[model samples]
Target: AYVITSRCAGFKDGACREVCPCDCIYDAGEQFVINPDDCIDCGACVTACPVEAIFADIDLPAEHSAALHFNRAFFES
Candidate 1:
């Protein structure tokens, strides 16, 4: 799963969603989120984000780790 960090909060560019082969990326009001269960870990969205806000779960920066949980919560709720 890839998490969208704070840098993407206002961007909502949708580039990640456009290139996602699984269609896992979705609009979550403030930012785009990736559905962990549906994501294929293809790394396409990572490169598509102009803000460089997407990060793989394991590779997520310490400051942006909360984004991972936020992403999962979006799907859970």
Candidate 2:
């Protein structure tokens, strides 16, 4: 699972969607979200995000960043 963090927690410009290989990204109101099932973990959307908000579950460096996993799950469920 991956997440868009505070670094990329602003407007949902969808640059990530443009580069997503699996089309897993979803527009979640004010931000963008990734569907856990659809995401291939290709990491393509990470670089496409202008704010660098995207991160893999194991790569999050901060405690708050952990929320991305749940966020993705919630969006998918």
| Backbone atom clashes (below 3 Å) for every candidate | 0, 0
TM-score of 2: 0.77
C-alpha RMSD of candidate 2: 2.1
lDDT of 1: 0.89
lDDT of 2 by residue, 3-56 (tens): 766554556768989988888777766567778767788888887777777888
What C-alpha RMSD separates each model from the true structure? Answer: 0.7, 2.1
| CA lDDT for candidate 2 | 0.73
Tens digits of per-residue lDDT for model 1, 1-77? 77888889888888999999989988888888888999989999999999999999999999998898889899997
The 10-residue segment with the lowest total lDDT in model 1: 1-10
